[model samples]
Target chain A: MTLPPLLEQSVAFLLPYDFSPTVLLVCAGAALLYHRGWRRTRGGWGQALLFWLGLLGMYVVLQTQFDYYAQHSFFMHRLQHLVLHHVAPFLIAVSAPAAILGAGLPDRIHRHVVAPLRRNRLLGHLYAAIQEPLVAGAIFVGLIYFWLIPSVHFYAMLSVPLYNTMNWGMAIEGLLFWWMIFNLRAPGASDMRHYGYRLLVLFLVMFPQIALGAYIALSNHDLFGIYAACGRILPITPLIDQAIGGLLTWVPAAMMSVVGGLVLVYRWKRQSQQVEQPLSPTLGCAR
Target chain B: MPRFKRYLILCLLPLLLGCSEEPPGGWYGHDITGVMPDLEFNLVDHRGKAVTAEDYRGKIKLMFFGYTSCQHVCPVALSKLAAATRELGDQADQVEILFVAVDPKRDKKVLDEYVTNFTPDLVGLTGTQEQLKAVAKRYRVAFSYEKPRDNGFYIVNHSGAVFAFGPQGKTRLLIDDQSKTANITADLRRLIEQSSI
Candidate 1:
């Protein structure tokens, strides 16, 4: 006999506990690796805080009523996407958890997951190729468009596994994009030009979202049938919710990248200014 | 200005370019428009007739989910909805309130009397618990009945938000339970005008 949907969901999330098993397992794994890595390197509190916060944020985003509400509300679903894509990635990027995570992972898991990607010729080459600024920017922007299609969103909302994959994909990819924008690596390509490329990609990422937000805000019809009939939690209309969600996407979501880009530009200018300049020999001795 | 300041201004220039005209229909209710169409339900109305979504085709359906015995939010909301429709004046005839009872037991007996107190146009629908649940699910409403009290009476907690469906049966907007009568009337007016009901 087919069990009731609500009962099934409660059993999956709450019977054993109020938390998701996936969230618990992931947190456990991340904590283990982070602790192991921290013990080995004695990383500073800033990095530690960022990593933990990212993990915690992901856990909250996954386990909270926000996820449940998202099933019935378009506005909440949009906010969830924003948090997963922008906020989660920014946290992970700031943490710079690569070395710590790699070091912390068990040897077997690391070998199977990390070593293969690093050693495989085709995959390694593909990774190197995508790291190129233009390619990375394209993929990031393309993914944003690809996932926002109504059918794609409808299907993702209906399926648990697909939705989870979408969330994870956005987080990992967005983290990678944010990492590139942060750009703490040794200078490559044209030194100053690389910084410009980072800033350019950062600025470009905001455009499509703003445009999409504008469209949603202006739309007169319910674009997604899934969230259409679900009534409001607050005393607002679906159009108002869509408009608010649109404004949310348009403003803060876009501004975050813009602000990040401005910081990069500031650093670029400061760094260049910090370079030593020689005085004219006739006027004064070179410093 | 310093070059840094100039660059920053240039970066922010794009953000200032987003001025679009206002959308059609200056609405008081939250504009749902063509978003999701409100779902249809198959149930017995107070008059003992099987009413379907198609039955409400030519008039705006102001829907609420509550039991007749609801003591708090439900009564206040139903009264407000009734008042708002009354405020529609001559056009009030174009509006019908559908009171979907979530408490299958208590609601079935008292539903007719509960709704008639508001308006003759108001409809009260009830069915088996499973049938009620299926309709509630369609509308994404949360409803649960409590065990019987010492006096054999219990409350059925349900969603209190009101749905305003256009004459074509599409969900046009959501009305807050706490919204003032004037605002609800204004929204209903706009819905009727826009839908040309």
Candidate 2:
């Protein structure tokens, strides 16, 4: 659907520059105080509420940025999607008060709440979810594939809301899928010492995008329609921006893989050393 | 003349090869992934107060080891971290995120300003070369400095993972390069719960 030009221009103006309005900050503070008392009253409810609030705040900032950047060029629009869906959710997750929530509960109440999560039905479901490494792998790989596809990417660029949905949806869903898989505490078969394996999976996951990037860098063709049309006003060329995106994707992914491999190797060596060494007699005797 | 040549050759051998000894491999705890040695180091914060692994005890710590000059990943990681804390709201009070510069020479005020751009709660740190080496050694985090030839721009090689520590100042988990917020939060949640006395 074609956006009204006036509406598009206004949203475009607001998207890049939108900050957390003063009123929202005050409300967020008030919400914090309101939630503090609830912390003792409910088990995980407070945490869930806080999580939603945080998500809402982020959504506001991201939406504005998305709107602003989407109007200007395809590259900034993609970046907005990157921040909104992938990075934002992850940040929100990191900010979660799991430790506080877990600690504050009384043992009885905690057990009452947590017992259901560990029951056969829940455990069975969780176990199945965590066991499917391919599912997580697919989500990670698929998101990159779908978004990076030239036709699909350009389509999203043309329709701002579609771009928001596709980009953010892929990112959020991908993170959730990976979260379940990587989480050691999740149900399913427990031992996952193959740190190298996990690293390789993500490496393979990123390989296609890198391949796409190399193709873009080498090709003489002007692929992106949006950039091709709006050439004069935009400061940078689409090809250069595309190359930068490709570089961003590959370099960080490669580094993560290498460091992850080193950490894995280091750990495997340590675990083997521990096995070879005699246990402390006192600790063994205590057991 | 023959004796002088031999002496010069002998002197140059240690300078080149000796500096390349691999960093120590042993660390104390199991991080988010595998069992590895806890890296140890001493560096001063933006406030000029010195901090060690000990000082960070009693709180869940998120540590990112990077220099201020890093153009991409470091800033992205720090920005995401700030976003996470902003997302955390009250929960942020319990967490401390630190950015330690691998490049000690240019790190101090520069990193401090850079970090504050992301979040007030974030602390920027640097140290003397000896101190940086010691800290990087303990963490098993690696870094190398490259001198600029023509261009003013030079680069330092450094690790990209953000290490998470439990309340006791023990290394609990590694954030890795992925920087997935959910995975980090999930692990931190588990660590926080497990680490409490």
Candidate 3:
């Protein structure tokens, strides 16, 4: 009685789509506006869009794997995890100034939501809390090794609830991981070089996965029965899927390194402009 | 103007003189109070011994907050603490190291074993969720659990400073995560000697 047929249909339609990307954009825009308008709108949005485009590309990669092979092929399953968990989220975090949210949002929403957050003491504390390096770093490394070990990953793969939980867990980990690395908030502050170094550290974090993936690809051991089943169904050989899995680990991770570097450059230039701004004539005359 | 300048220089004299320190080292350059906040708590140790902040009195306690399930930083910090203790040799006796598990639910007994695997001297501590919150609040330590989507496995967020407590059982210093073992050893030695005096 609570659910009519049309009501059920409407609820089903509303369930799948996520508004997270738009929410993030609005938040970024608000932060940018609070800092004042970008020196150039198109340029700032373009850079942000470029980063968003890269994120979209990675998301597509994830969607393809999730749709086609998550349950069907072990190799595709792992690749999907890698893309969603590590690759796409990092691209999104480093892609903006806080201004994206401000620029994109309507005035009424800005007054109601954005204005309040800018003044919020709890939000400030929350920001400070997450920026704690030890907390953020541990979460990142913990999720990786915890999920990577054969015992855990194998069990998660076998169980439906665990598989879904872990898949999203990695993405959340990815968000927290890059938030510490990309966010300008304090409690833990690292310069551009440190950010660059941390990316290398993250790359090393995934090294074990690459090695394991490569080992699985090269060896005849079919840990999962599905990989064997899919090998028979596919046009290409199983070797190709295995190779793709290993290569995907290192190759896509390079995107994170490049993203880190670009964020460093962007932040540094923004800082320099603020620091080296020419003094007003009125102020100079007073001096 | 000369009198004003004299007073100005007089006020600034402490800033200059305060920069000076004793022979090998001094912890005066940084504002220790800003880096470390006063914290007090009652908890239990790995051995199930009832413990409180008072137990660490008279010794300079080096405290690191983390969970046993942590794969990298926790072990790295404990190893560094061990290495620092080794580096101190005799002086290590004066410094007490404590690791408080942020995820007390799973980490209570689990961390106890994990930490012992690294160093017997390192004490692993935990309490009920409410108690952990009280301790974390007092210490200005931040932590959160990201809800697990499918399985019950989620990450615990926590602060990662190696806090140094004075002999009087008050937080007196904080060593940033990047602080090296050699620097930690030197700092601990100085804190131990200073507190004794």
Candidate 4:
């Protein structure tokens, strides 16, 4: 059936520019699992909203006509990364969906597949290694530097496979990094025990990002010629685009660190309070 | 000491494998072997004949996207490419420049005359919007048109890159506007020589 013209146009705009089956499958699967879990647990609406918004934000940037703009425009590409690597992942991780996702799995699948995978010694060791606070923090910043190297960026833009790898790498690394920061389990139970160390890592990663962004913004010359080589989608000057992209990389991305630090401080305080009153009968009285 | 030697060997293994010797000097253009897919497209030639990339299989193909009416960039780029091919002397026939026009509305009438003004080795190509979009998407380039003025004059923005492919259609190098004619000529020579062997 034919829809109204305006609705048709909107639908067309939402369609993927370069469709990838893998993106479609992963997003759909996540949405399905989250919905099932949310229903079964009668999850809080606030957390569910954050989870859905984060998932939808990632899918939109990666799969819609937005992807085309991100590819062709420097500023738009930076905006896409801001959402993918910072905003969306942060929201998802902050919602603390791990327990809900675990509950979402069917009993048989959890027993035979998920449980086995989680118990694998090599997998556990690898997870522990990457989640080590210092290593995780380094990887979080290193990936940004690695992909932005002018020579590497040129090839990543020109080649489809390299471009896909760069994007997927950013997204996966963002999830892992933010997950480490925001995991809601007690310090004694989680892989990373020190809230102080996580806070330090958050603060440490900010400087390099600011320096790189300032260098790109303040330079008179174009650092990324790939955007010029492939024509820009918008009519803005190259310098203006570079400046805006640099500002995005500079301000909002670094501000995420401050926000994460605040969350950790709150959690740290609450955990301390819980420890102090562990055996008190009036523990619920505070609430 | 033995363990240290083993660690050193392990570190050096990747360097040894990755640093295979090249000629005295590598091609001036960015060597992009195996990065992009093989050159391929379906479009209409200036002669109104439908053609695919296979039609020009034996020659080194240099493909770029622009409109014929693009006043500055298209002319300068075409001339530089023409000069590069001319520098090849008799071996000039070994190369073919595919100039794909992204703006079909205005280009269709004048594309033949425009390309002929540059070099005989260059072939002007245009196609339906779908076909043009497919080709542009394949190359990861982009093009957009500005709104026309009252007198019907407009501007089109398009990629300034020339993608060079080997005789067998293998992706080879990308020549941007900053590349010198000499550099392009040298890289083309290397591509032609390598393909012949």
The prediction achieving the highest lDDT against the true structure is 4
**lDDT per residue (tens digit) for residues B1-197 in model 3:** 99999999999997888666442236521224433345567788998887988787777787887887777877887888888877888877777888888787788767667867878778888888877767754544445676675877766656556777877876676565656788777777777777877
lDDT of 3 by residue, A1-287 (tens): 48999988766544422224543464455445533434433435654664565455445543432333444445566667666666666665666444543554568878998789977999978766755555566566567657756546544543444655786687767766776666544434434345445555555555555555556656564443323321222333556665665556545554554556566666666655655774522110000
Measured with C-alpha atoms, the lDDT of residue A143 in candidate 2 is 72
Residue-level lDDT of model 1, residues A137-236, one tens digit each, is 7787677667668868755654456667877787777776777766444335434667877887778778887898888878897676545433344445
lDDT, candidate 2, A30-135, per-residue tens: 4464355346635356445645654565555454544444434545544554444444444334334444445544578657877667576978676567445556
* Candidate-wise lDDT, in order: 0.72, 0.57, 0.61, 0.87
Q: Is candidate 3 or candidate 4 better by DockQ?
A: 4
Interface DockQ of candidate 1: 0.06
Q: Is the docking of candidate 1 incorrect, acceptable, medium or high quality?
A: incorrect
Off by over 4 Å in 2: A1-67, A81-127, A177-182, A185-188, A192-196, A229-233, A259-287, B1-197
Per-residue lDDT of candidate 4, residues B1-197 (tens digit): 99999999999998887676442258777778898889788899987889999999999999988998888998889889989999999899999999999999988888888877777788999999999999889888899998898999988989888989988898898888888898888888888889989
Residue B135, candidate 1: C-alpha displacement in angstroms:
11
TM-score of chain B of each: 0.82, 0.75, 0.80, 0.86
Worst 10 residues of 2 chain A by lDDT: A278-287
Off by over 4 Å in 1: A1-20, A107-113, A183-192, A266-287, B1-197
Residue pairs with backbone atoms closer than 3 Å in model 1 (clashes)? A221-B34, A221-B35, A222-B34, A222-B35, A228-B36, A239-B31
Candidate 4 local lDDT, A3-121, one digit each (tens): 99999999998999999999999999888888888889777898889889989999999999999999998889999989999889998888888767777878999999988998899
Off by over 4 Å in 4: A1-5, A184-193, A277-287, B1-25
**Candidate 1 chain A — worst ten consecutive residues by lDDT sum?**
A278-287
List pairs with backbone clashes in candidate 4.
none
